[model samples]
Target chain A: MATAPQLPTTRPLWARSPFYFNSTAHLLRIGRGKANNLQELLEALRLCPDSSIFRHTFQTLEEHHFIKEGFSNDFSHWAFAACNEVELAERLAIIDVREFTSIATLRDRLVLIIEEYLQKNPRAATRTAMEPFYLMDSDLVVVPTPYVARNLEEFADGLHKISIHSIYYHFIDARLRLKLNNNDFSIWLEKELDLAQAADRINRIDIYTSTLEGVRQNILKIIEIELATPDSAGPD
Target chain B: MKDKNPDRKTAVEEKNAEKNSKARDPKQQQEPATPAGQAAPQELAVPAAPSGTRERRFRQTDLPARVIERRKHPRISMEQPLPPAPPCLDDYVSIIGQPELDEIRFLARRLRGKTVKMVNSTAVGGGVAEILNRLIPLMNELEVPTRWDVITGGNDFYEVTKGFHNALHGGEYNLTQQIKDIFMSYSEQTRQRMEFTEDLFIIHDPQPVGLVHSKSQERGKWIWRCHMDLSNAHQGVWDFLKPMIEQYDAAVFSAPAFACQLPIPQYLFYPSIDPLSEKNRELPEEYINKVCDDFGIDRSRPVITQISRFDRLKDPVGVIEAYKLVKKYVDCQLVLAGGGATDDPEGAVVLQEVIEAAGDDPDVIILNLPPWSALEINALQRASTVIVQKSLKEGFGLTVTEGLWKEKPVVAGAVGGIPMQIIHKLTGVLVHSVEGCAYQIRYLLTHPEFATQLGKNGKEHAKENFLITVNLKRWLVLFQILLGMAKPNATI
Candidate 1:
């Protein structure tokens, strides 16, 4: 028997561990997990081609397979399929960066990526093409036991407290504080993001000493704000 | 050989000798025979006017009737049609990419409600004029309400300004009191004769740098946009002009290094090309072929051409040296075609020198055309197998951008904004010397594949960076920033 799904208590709603779990579960129920490798998974998903996101991934995976094949003298149909895949991959790969390795990294990367994608692709909101999912609600479980009504008001109060705790880390200051002990990685992210943001702020960047220091301070302020957010919020 | 036909051979030899002697010194008169047919004694005679003055006359007036009839057809000049007054920016930006569109909108907001009037000497025949002719319309399309005005002057004023130009470019010039007075007198006359609105006024180049004094308290946003390389300008000239320049709200230069330590804020804006313009737009193979045929340039042999004003800074003479070096490896011809600007007095003398240096070489064609010769320049560039711009000093050579847009690989001097356009060995080859230019030309001629690659990359780069659409977008954003309608965005 399969184990029940569990939600992490310390992340934001969008960054929670259960989000991708729910999405993959839907794909698994649809027989997508029968795929033995990334290539197979891409091909299987391509059969239905549910969302533009899925379509983009399928195309990239197909190109990865072709490059690995190294120009085999296959039939025209096979060659053309690879050609189409490579073309699509080339177009989408322009936006691809390093993949996330940890759940926290994934949460951060996904939110940023989705926000940028939405900004660029406003029409995507109108398209009802993205996949949806249903999470398992264990509270609905029917157990063979007598119901006990003990401290109902106390239960509601605890519920409210837990809700606030779940969201406290979402603020930038909270993330900075949590990652303070991991200074190198936090500093690296802060520096990179500050540079990118500052670059987008000015018409032309002055590479003077003052401007460089100003960029550093600007990003550090964002980190400070992250660190000061109430613990009731979730991770950034 | 069996004894030469004595009478026939001597007759031919005598005729050849006469022809050679006449050609040898056409500037001298033929020796007159004495009355008694005796060898005339060499007489110490008074110098007479040049005998070839008749030959030196402009030949355009002496064309045959048929040729004259052809002229009646009303030839299309560089000024013809004027590119249909450029379409509104809305139609252009709508199809442009988002980043580019946003850039235009941002610029539009900054420049909104501002009327910028750019005044330059000579509305044609020079780089500054050619650029303004295109730039002004585009600025207006962005709703900046820009206008271009040309200052008129007589020969004395032009001669003085030409000295000023050379002096500002570090040439050893004595900016005497007479020259200063002459320049000032012309400026004062222009100020009195012309109408200037109380808007953002820009005076371009040293020719009109003194126009700042004409500005009144009501005048807004006075900018002196200098296009010449002033890094090593004569201190005397700069000192004379400094006080008037500081009166402006800001100064604009093509390069940061060209900016002086003026009290006013300095903005560095590189000149750009309009890709959609006739001079730059892609021409079909048939049209390119026709242009070459029409120009009397044979496409069979490699054609190396330099299209620039007859100014010495462009170094048309150096271009010849580079072409000669390349010609040693491959059979090619050189074409130097350009005209004089109204404000540039040295162009005529320099053009005469260029022609003399070129000699009677059939491969060297020097066309001293009028200012309105854009199509001919376009045809020559399109027909060129290799285009070179060997400038001793330049303020962003637009010819490089023009050649690149046409997908013709250029070998240009790595000065000013040239490097900004030609990525060495990529979009085009940027050389520092005539020898380097020659070597690059030879390489491109030898490696057809590399030439094609460079041309393609250059075309794409021009489309992305220097199109009229991009220029208009920049103006719009600049206006927005100036008007306080929007803050300028820093690009990463």
Candidate 2:
């Protein structure tokens, strides 16, 4: 096999700035927008606040972090559980949140998916849900934790020590908040440490297939492998 | 961009200019500006006398006979000094880790100066009183300055409110004008007697809900905490209470289904139990055995338990019916342990029915424990093989949370807040009927390994979501939002 070029271990000064670990606790409030049928749901999605879009999609990962089965978002869950719309539910469930950055785009995608489904099955538009879907939004109360990492060794240690909530905040939530295609950890690793290969490896981690704890274990494994590289320095 | 409504924009500009001119005056500048949507403290028409001064005025020799007659009721009792809190913030660090504790402290720091006052119908019985008793002390320990007040009323008042409670839980009530008058009369007396000095007032349940009539923008924000299931509330009772409920700055419900479509923003708050409290604290094997012996519950045989008040809503008769069905398949004993709340006048009647339903069944035991029998209840729960909470209509079903916290397989009714706690065979099994409850009990008794796993998952679920620490965090966050310290919908 041909040998790949060795990457440099040294990093720029900006990349060495410590990553402060933060976590969020949400204060959930019921939004004014509610829907009883598919047509009404489409209207509510069009007019509902961006935070509601964030809540049903991105925040659902944290809320239902334990469940390994079923649809990922509340909309799909409601569609299947309440409306008995299996085909539409599956379609909505497949709209992966990772594809979009801004909540506006995510909302548009949801609207588009529902619209397309309604076009295909016109009767589905008039089908009433067993229970009304009440739109809810959460206010994120972010608090910095004691864990901070200035280097890869400390980053692995911090990841091991921090709560699963912190992991969700940095890995999943930061994607929408930062309006970037990548998560906070990947962004920092590539921007500051000049570790684009390592960042890309992390960015490729399948978030949908695993729990938050599972994600943490995978990240720790990757960091351990990186730390074993010949030129990699131990914690500074 | 140019203003779309030029005249309206100009009028707003002129008003702002006038306000600014007034602000430029030295006298106007000397006074602190009240935030928009908030009234100045002085604008409260009620006298802001210290409680002691108010008491002194009541003792004046020249007081009128009408005043003295009105004082006979003494509706609002001052906050009784609490005993020392058993589980401080540091104590919870063992159950929930240090990071969770630190987060609670951080949220509390934002609400350091604000005062919280919790008002309910009773001071010693029921879930609301028990939570307030522990919560107030712990919040004060966190330096949040919390107090609790119990509103006292005559027996007629309680009877009427009990009817209101049942009606709110979707039971039928006549809801006559007499009932309305009794509710408002007691509420008015409570309003007159109590001092509304706290920065935040939490009016719990419908009994004290009418006190929102005293809400002034100059005073602190008022929140109506509806701890009942109002999804199918009687329209007449709801209409009577709607205006007062709408007057609140916000409303909080135990579950999403418990909320009505009110104009004010509604938040979902799950009621919690104190792990360090006698009702939930870990008990020794010897103590558990003694409790079982005391109740005549056979330890060798599988013991199923349900702990709740002797209220009709709890469905103790339904529990007995389920136990009889399970008895056919398994040689198990059922322990139905509970006491009565002071405000629930119908408990005695329901207790009679439960006793009759369980008549002469050697395998079934019913213990009418007192309110202070926390240790005994904890031991009984710890000794049980499985726990069940078969409520026909429930208010959050704290008993189910208590059972799950003890790491016991729980079979609860899929109503109110019970479903939120029991995640349908994931944490614990949620049953809809006596037959389903019996079926699950028999299944769990037969499948020991799966039962143990459910128990373990149930404990983890309770630890994560239903512990007192999480409830404290929710309150602190709500305080932050109401006090303008944090935005209601802001993201990190």
Candidate 3:
């Protein structure tokens, strides 16, 4: 292989780095302690001895190899969500959809990981958060497929050829639901900075990209910038 | 710009005698027609009241008693010290996290002696004033010398600016050349009298947006902080204000989406609450009980509360409608808590409508609180079973953040920054209509476990996201970036 495989490694800068959280679950990890209740959390905050406070969020996406029932066998994907289509999630413990909808919930589930799960599926990694977790490799990987192409143009062309393949539609609904849930922060972005206009764009925008995947990628990229955008210094 | 001498104070008092005579003349005042098209209120001929009098709490500022009094005996421009810096932000480690602490430290070190001045119209009312009260102190404590100054204007000036405020918030307001002339004249007056030279001068909202024209007459890097939602700004008004806004070095907005077609680098700035402030602080049982008794609220009952200024935009009437729907399905009390801002003329009118909407419903408790009632505000939030912020349009709903801080599950309108706080079914619920609000409230009250979890999650979210420490970090990063000490694309 010309490129090394993308694997999960701890984020290097996270260490000796100030703690940042994506959600409330990360807030509970101060003093290497978890808040048992809201009162306890408030008390801890009031007494929190650290002089500097900052917010930073971390996510780890790892590739996993799983076999299909027939035809094309092995495939790899990077997900914070549990996989079920290829029975990979079933191979591990089943994730109740109700319980694992948020970043906080996923962090909690990762905390209670069984030793067997890590051993059997070394690639079945959960994103570690808040506390000083090890730095992980972020190099992205693509799993080998029988439909692999020769180049970027060839790969895009090959994907178009398989546009109607069942593989693409199998988990489309569930993936779309998760994206809708987690990717809607554009609406709440504050300041006299209102997203009313951007929201209008979301509704009115026509697909100008070459493919649905291309449009999804563009949307995701914009979301990354919007999410990374800092809060306004303007009035509430 | 004002130079004070003890001897000049005596002369200034003499000038007041002359000015006071003119202040009493109705012909001397220029009354701008109300933008909402209501009949102009009569200007009171009485001498403006003493600064701290009980009557100072009156609603309209068309001719602020204080402003009239000040014009009568115009004193040297005095630089008032803001509230002392609250406890060091470093003390908030477990809450704000460490990343914020490091950034503040870095920015403070970079801009050690630089002075930043903030100017706004009203000093007491509105979100801009409320946020500055807390933010100035925090910024000062972080070792950034910051000052907050209010622009001096009269009935004609503030009324005109109020029209601008309404127009920016999407109301159909037309700025006649007469109003534009008054705005520029007053802004020029403020520009001449006040010191506009600082490392950074933040002109807030529309009231002070005209102050940028003063930049030509002064020396300072100016950033206009617009806190109103202008997504639906009336184009006529926007066109009139665009050139004036373009005079600033940069513009800051509360949300990225509110960024218009401005030709300046715009930074997103979110407002935050001081965790240690009276409004968000943990209250003793004694204080909570006393407040509950005072308000006739039974803490044991399911209390659904909304704390916001009694503005039409806050939709207090809509809240009443939602409360009535919830009351039909389940037994619960709705507490509509808020007060009038000194600068807003429309509060009293909207408040009357809210009262009329409430009628004789004993279950609906409307406590119209006054300014400086932070403890009572805190107690009401603590006593609440669920907090609601159902705004029709919001810049960023601070009340919702406050509710979430108190560990109360909030049901807020799915508008503006409410979605940032509620996160729909995760921290709290976001609703679009009265029925939806009622449905969510009923769902929460009937399901205590779900509500409790939501509240817990909300408190954690507020702790991480909406606290002042997080805001300070972002602000410091802004300072560093502007000063060329940090990456322009820095994520604080």
Candidate 4:
């Protein structure tokens, strides 16, 4: 139910947006709490000229905890952000551990992770990390309306529940669970792809995985085209 | 007819004889197990008199050993008359034109005196029932003696079949061993009751697929007409049905994409919409306006609508989310109107979620019509600026065809037979996500000329590809092939 922030029309004072990645304790020094995107969060903490507005907006998680001070600005290195952002990916990876790595390495890693995290909950491994952007028109900071210092505990529980039970999320989970419980995912993938040797090359599945193994090459083509464009540019 | 298969003859004869000797008396001829068989019987053999206070319906009578399977199940042994369509096949001339009518009549010449029968689960309420209501009658008019038979099962049997339906369309299901027994045993009983075959016994979908087990008694051909997406059927269920499906002389799927690996020759045919049906016939503009007024839908604003039975797979909630997105941009009113089918029990639950999602949004209207509201359905389609069929998975969306027949632009899911109908931007738009649905609806509303042109193209496409006349032609050719009058590899 977490909504992405819709930017105001005119240049505003304080711009606050929710950070969407599952943040662990090691990466606590990331967001002031609320942030638009990772780049904005990193900019607010240690990289920006003014960091006070971010500190004020990204307030206590419930009572004590504030947004992480600063550690690694490297988390927003475009790739993960371009996909499900940080918090969302961490939350998702908590269920399907294959998500933690890059797409290129998913096939090899997915089977191993499914074996390890089948019914286990490494909950603390995916602690809450939000990076919201604050709206500031130079002098006065503008507060976004739906801004309540969201409970970190509640958010974490929501992510956990979503990963487990939400229809779209549970689909892959159910498939993965079948794999872990003596069901050969590779053999299933073989019939799914109508492949003779797909079971040999890949024993795991990506979320975008199709019955057609040949289509994986097509995704690479998209990545190539996507990389050619400038950061700000989007698909036409 | 023997390929030196005499070694198997003794075994086949024994099985056939065993089936021929059933527990029923001659007057109680068992009905063929239709997928959409009628639920309410005209006169049932109720208890002679009430003896004592009943705690519940069950534990009241001498309950069967499989009490849940037999008693708790939905009513199975009922019969409904074929809905009235064209009394004479000749009436289609003005609609389909003379050459097409003549063409169908010419094609029907070889099918005379040959028998064809349809086996489905229900005799009322779903698309299969609706189509056979008209198609069977029309075939009879063409001098082919075609019959429609429905199978009976209690409520438990339907619940299991509904699960299989969802699972075949890529939805998850928890099909326990008990439900599997319920499915197989009931199918066995129905098969025993209606084991007789004609020149062609066309079994529709998985409900009566077990009837193929009676192929030993087959004096002629049997065709398995699957009306759902089997591309992602649950592996276990598929494994169970695959052998039975393979035994058929041939199989028919609604789209080429639904085809799966099998040694038997498989044919693809789209489910057709009847042009003269109450739901598809062109309506007067004023009547359309009255439905809008009755539903409290605003005629002034751009109207976006989706009319589907309230089933989870139909993705009514997803449609609501898409409307919310479109509502952010366009000043429009969204209407989601649908009813229930006897086969599906999840309709009420899904309807509640749809209502909750639309939640106090005055612009969003939800209407739950009865199963017989064909005219109201017609009016809604006519009144709509755009019609959306945002299903997560579909078999062949005849509702999509119905909307197209009315020359209304449709936004539908790219799944199932929808892609065969909507050629992306050509006939209509096919959406993969809720956002895509909203974006397409917004685009069409903004660009009326393009939407109108798409609708025109959609109408022409449905006429050529998805009408009963075209379907009739195909069935005739298949009949010819079965009768050895046409080449096995022949195409219409």
Candidate 5:
């Protein structure tokens, strides 16, 4: 596995709702604590005097193994809803059943697909099963699932680039469906920005993306740069 | 987009202002349209009187003739204190188990020194307040410093917030600048007057959402706990409130789909009921009998009860309509009992509409009890053969949980948090409309064996999911994750 350089200063993915996870990370960093395992994380949180429902709910999930615990005892970097098939199925059943239809369907398909694929090519099926869902766009190819961030810095830098790719794909899809030319980008972009000024429109987009990803990319016209590609194979 | 329709906007604004004034001033109000869609008796426009006055008026209007006569005859003084409630700890422990006890200890160990404060709009009538009344004491017993606070405002604030609530539910209600100004002024006043020293600040619902803006010098984790279902929120309202919501340290929603693409990590917590509370606790047979007699409910006829605030969304009239439909085959009485929260100004009108819809039908009883009438609620639920929650839109019907906990099979709206409890053919039945609700109600009444099984299954499910003991453990784990104490080997 290759790791990126340092954590980026800004992340577009994070800016969407930076407070929850960002504050949790910041709080973990504050107490001079290194929590790798579920137990250790519980130990650190137990130190906090306030009985916040958020912390309590997480602890319950860990105890029940609804989420998968990390390999390291220091749980600074953790995954969201980390779990296995049985528990995942239980969680899935409880979900609102409205959103994530594709993901839900894919999960259902995976069981059958893996079985069939294995019958055809056992070696490849086994290898693919071991590998996670690495993000694959239409043009640019990334090795890791989503974007691989060696550290937080790269994670932040690639946030907007990745998002811009998604945005452009959506824009182009709508444009093609409506039989509109690519020239409609400026009008749509202005409407999206909801601003009077055109000069700093991309900057405003970067801010919007930052809220989603927790940090922003360094490149300002990263949307234009990423828009060179036609489409993406996976969700943003 | 709004700038394009200024004239239309003003017209709607004028209509709302007229409605609001009529709601506030009894003199300007007329009787609500009856069940047949005709004008009915003119109800006095009371300035949304407090619980005491409202209770007196309700007793005068709705209480059984015998009960009223008895009251006048002075058999027992209204001031006579009721007997002390029975010891509930043993029973609570027997059902919910010892983990609750251990979790409380651990919670005390963690939060003993810190203060946890809860802020909401209403203190006496709403579900949040009801839960807090029991929960705060339990927290204190466990040695965690806990306090509950009620945000104060006049009618204008509540009326504006009610509009915001409807808007959040995708209702096409546009609020004016004047209403916005009133809301801001109240928020500002509350921010100045409120003492914000707690380690954890929990603000519930849209009424106090702006309180996060008040956080100046003291910076702690501010959680905006939304109790409503936001899946279909009106775009205009969501767009307006999203920025304010973003300011919170974290956002907590009742269901997963209720969560949006906020940068904050959203936690899904199903609201729960305390089995130990007066409203939820089991009542004696005599008390149940007395309540049944007082409410003019026939003990022989299979009784169906839906206890909820008389809001349009609860569909009280729709509930009666369902009961009437069901009554065509089997003889069953319906009890629609609940009081309005202080914040919902439209409750009285809705209640009146329900009363008129019920008509002179002796079997259909509409009881708008006071907020503190816990024993009455318990009696009603106990006396009920079937419980129905016919809500058009619901966040979580705590009444359903309460009814299920009391071992009554329920037919509820398949919306919001209700589905989180009623598991179709398993625990209880979930219905979408009046016809569906009536079908389920009829099914339960016809099949006594199946109804009993459903009631038993519902109680078991309630024990597993909607109990406060389970809620306490969930909170414990969420805290552990925040403190970075989750097991490294554990997977979610």
Candidate 6:
């Protein structure tokens, strides 16, 4: 009779609210800060608004998503394309945006990279760019789409159908907006569904290697895999 | 349908009734019909009210009512019976896909009940009018009430505005006090005549930039939409116009490089083309062959074409030079075809120069097609082996967009907004000189597969970026931001 103790039953953790999908539209505007040379660029990097930094980094991915091979951020592209600073461009491009959650930290990293490069090569600071870097930012309007996902199955379907802009809003843009080190999908997957492994797989998606559409496909694949497991389902 | 201007309709109806009554009665017929405060029709001694005086009086008293009439029913601007229904939001789903259309609908849904009015210089000739012709209907279809009005001006006013247009495109022009006065006088007249009652007013280009002076008295947000390149604008012209531009709540440019430093925010909006329109719609092969035969274009030989106005800024002469260079290596025929606009007084002069540069080459065909020959132009573009847009200065190089949308390999100048459309061998080729353009043309001719790939890529780029749906979405987003229904989260 005392051979086995009663074991607790495994239960699911469900979210209080469904995840409402949202798409973002941008109203791009010229920012006050601009730069003609590496010195001015560094100064602008320090003084430009946080939104400008976000635009040059995160929004750039969406803007130039069609291009297969290029720098992922505007600063690197400008450094290489405008200033012909190959080493500097490489360094700037290597500063992954996903490594930081906030724009302030991103700005610090950008400033630090440029400052270090300038300290070593003093003449590079005065090197003039072919075209000036115009700091630009956008007014982000998040619109709620009709797509809503209450569980993993619905999320998989939503991923298959949502616009690329919605994917961008949730995956890359939410990190800065929500001050999370991970994307919206991963956070929701972990916090609501208690699916940490699937969430970690989604977070590991390489943004630089893929387009927004590519990212959507990868996310869909991960979600589909999770949905295939018997334990993926929650209580009816 | 409800009558938009009931008062004017009533007046017209009363005048008609009085005339009918006079015709019915012998005594009344004997008495000359007279306006309420004017002399009778039989009073020849009054010298006919000094030519336009009576008409001017009628206009001044009832101008606002007429404007309201035009705004409520856009068909009044044309004075024609209502035509067939225009392509709605669903019509665009075929071109831009369902998701894109859904996004536009979502944004437009948030902008419901917001009224928009677009003011420009012309209603017949240029790209702005053509856009509004299609855009207004689509916006109304989305439940966003939109109207378009063309500001009227005399030849003197138009001449000054043309000069300003050139200057803003980086050409030299003297901005004298007389010119400024002329522009302001016409602007003031237009402001008085038109009623600005919409929730958002988009005043396009510098001709109506002065209309923003009425913004303080009006109850709406004003936007100055500059469709020209202002990167190297003449300082004096920009100085004269800057104050008025600053009065707007925002400014929109066709490209980012065209924006200038200003206190108000500036937006980047690429001018778009309707894919389902006559100029861009797909055609039958037999019809294309007939169009080519009508234009004396040989279908057997390779045809390289450039479709744009014969303006010096478009560099039609440079295009001919490039064609000549390419002709040395590749035995291809070159077609330079375009139409003139009412606003461009210099078109004839440039067309003459282009003809001279062509120098009686039988292979070089220059057709001065009328503006209504959109289908012919479309046929010519579709029949082309390669498309070239060699402009020294361009606004947005929409011709390049058109060619790319037609899925023809394009070689465009690396100036203004051309670079935005042609991504240097990715979407299409970008060249800086006549020699470079010629070299690319020759290269594309030799490597047919590469050219085909470029065309495919170019079409996809145009589809993704420069469609009318994209333009509609941007506009709705801007309206939402202006109405304070959506906050622009600029800062983290």
Query: Which candidate number has the best DockQ?
Result: 6
- CAPRI quality band, candidate 2: acceptable
Off by over 4 Å in 1: A1-236, B1-84, B90-102, B122-125, B148-162, B171-199, B207-219, B298-302, B309-321, B324-336, B339-370, B393-395, B464-469, B485-492
* TM-scores of the models, in the order given: 0.53, 0.78, 0.55, 0.54, 0.55, 0.80
Task: Name the weakest run of 10 consecutive residues (lDDT summed) in model 1 chain A.
Answer: A20-29
Tens digit of per-residue lDDT, candidate 5, span A70-145: 2111111121221122322333233221111232232343234334433554343222211121110011111111
Alpha carbon deviation, residue B477, candidate 5 (Å): 2.7
**Runs in model 2 lying further than 4 Å from the true structure:** A1-8, A12-14, A32-47, A79-95, A108-133, B1-85, B152-197, B213-219, B234-237, B298-301, B309-313, B320-331, B340-362
* Cα distance off (Å), candidate 5, residue B138: 2.1
Candidate 4 residue-wise lDDT, B1-492, digit = tens: 111001113432334223333312334334323233344223322222112212123223232334323222312212222222232466566666654565567667667888887898877656787778678878888888887888889998988898898888778777678987998899899987874657888999999998887775538788998887777888878887888898998787776567677777566577898786657765566666656655665677788889998898899999999999998899887878876633345776676677678765656677665554676788788888999999987778888998888889999998767866775676789888998999999999999998997898788678766888878877887666656765431100
The prediction achieving the highest TM-score against the true structure is 6
lDDT string, candidate 2, A44-150, tens digits:
99998888898888887786665545638888877886677899889898877877888888998899999998999889887887667878877776767888877
TM-score of chain B of each: 0.69, 0.74, 0.74, 0.75, 0.73, 0.76
Which DockQ-derived CAPRI band holds candidate 5?
incorrect
Q: Estimate every model's Cα lDDT from 0 to 1.
A: 0.52, 0.76, 0.55, 0.57, 0.54, 0.77
Q: Whose lDDT is greatest here?
A: 6
Please provide, for model 2 over B1-492, each residue's C-alpha lDDT reduced to its tens digit, 9 standing for 90 to 100. 111111213432344334444544545442322212223222112212122211212233343454343232221112221122244467666677877787788788778878988888875446786677667767888899877777879999999999999898788889888888889999999899888888999999999999888887787999999888888999999999999999999998887777899999798788899897767865557666655655556678899998988887788899999999999989887888786633345776676676677765556666665454676788889889999999987778888999989989999987767877876676789787899999999999999998997888788778877888888888888888888887644442
Candidates ranked by lDDT:
6, 2, 4, 3, 5, 1
Error of 2 at B206 (Å): 3.2
Cα displacement (Å) at residue B168, model 2 = 4.0
- Across A50-106, the per-residue lDDT of candidate 3 in tens digits comes to 211111111100000011111110111111121222344232223322233343443
Candidate 4 chain B, poorest ten consecutive residues by summed lDDT? B1-10
Q: Give per-residue CA lDDT, model 6, range B94-176, as digits (tens).
A: 67777778888888887889898888877654678678767877888889988777787889988998899889878899888
